[model samples]
Target: EIIAAIEGLMKDPAVGHPLKGKRVLVTSGPTREPIDPVRYISNHSSGKQGHAIAKAAAEAGAEVTLVTGPVSLADPVGVTVVHVESARDMLAAVEAALPADIAVFAAAVADWRVASVADNKLKKGAGGPPSLAFVENPDILATIAKHGSKRPQLVVGFAAETEAVVDNARAKLARKGCDLIVANDVAPGTGTFGGDANTVHLVTPDSVETWDRQSKDGVARALVTRLAEMIAKA
Candidate 1:
């Protein structure tokens, strides 16, 4: 069934010729910043959306590479999957997997990491607790978007905002120097993180397209179709 779907996409002129022979890269899941051997900081991303995008792009006839953070999902057929744990690892992995025609930053990377990693578990003090300092992690999306060589022709970013979705998304798009930004609310009651459904606003410099809440697969198909069109025109 999956192969048949991919064959159908390959035969579809609108999606086929545009992505034919092109290389695409995608990032997914949550980066784990180690606090200790047994603990880490990460997000709630399930990597469903990113996986779907990789599948769709492969169906569209592109050579796809997925740089994923920790996730348990099976790798999509016809796509190269590189697994990484920390935000720094993800960044390095993505840089090494470059020369892609399009790059999608879909991973929910942690903003900070423990400044110092203890060699062994720290025991609680008699008086109080340990103070762990944190440092900012590299912004993967911004870094790839601004790379000098082997830069993707098109760069897209995901803005998982909790409030002011459109405004924050717009800011992220501009700040990250990405061509498109998919902004979605992850507030409580919204089934975004680890959920099958999503409601997102696609923000570009010229316009904003708000999509009705839909399944993650639906969103992936829609985004891939649009990407095919954009690449065809480019």
Candidate 2:
């Protein structure tokens, strides 16, 4: 209902289209890295938070482009959706949707991919356990945040951590060259992987804002408003 709220705000005389002319790009879900014809590597992200953010941005009157990975969620209304499968595909899609005013890298992209994928599923015979080699995937956030010409004015990234949440996020904010980092604890039993609610800490260069636990939609709405205000000040 966060997007619906934006519609409500639009009708109010006091609130206009704050992000009307802005271009927003959001990345969501988890990319799959192929291991074999029948197998792949992926994560447990449900795309709930990212989708909500995209919807919120669209509702706020921004021209939104959502680059997403495999998920079961429906596409957010009034937004352009680009579906991709792997980290490479996601990076390509993000690069194509360039010069965004705001970019949110919410996707839990794989850190590594299989070096060589099998053409066919390997049979479990006398070969025992097969050795699989891996290589690092492209750092999408870093690439976009460090872009020279096509860089978005504001770039955001997410840190799903089980320990040292704020510290790790702070490090990531600098390491990835992003303006903001949304950090959350995804330790087992947190119900963060597929749950609707989120407890997040927004880490920036100046300070950190820890928001109370709330639905993903609530967080999205608040974040969108905060970002719009920041852009306005800039």
Candidate that would win on TM-score: 2
What TM-score would every model get versus the actual structure?
A: 0.92, 0.94
Candidate 2: TM-score? 0.94
Predicted candidate 2 versus true structure: per-residue lDDT over 1-234, tens digit per residue: 999998988787437556888999999999999999999999999999999999999888899999999999999999999999999999999999997999999999999999999999988999798999999999999999999889999999999999999999999998999999999999999999999999999999989999999999999999999989988887
Clash number by candidate, in order: 0, 0
Best by lDDT: 2
For all candidates in order, the CA lDDT equals 0.89, 0.94
Tens-digit lDDT string for candidate 1 (165-190):
99999988889888999999999789
Q: Pairing residues by index, what is the TM-score of model 1?
A: 0.92
Which sections of candidate 2 miss by over 4 Å?
1-16
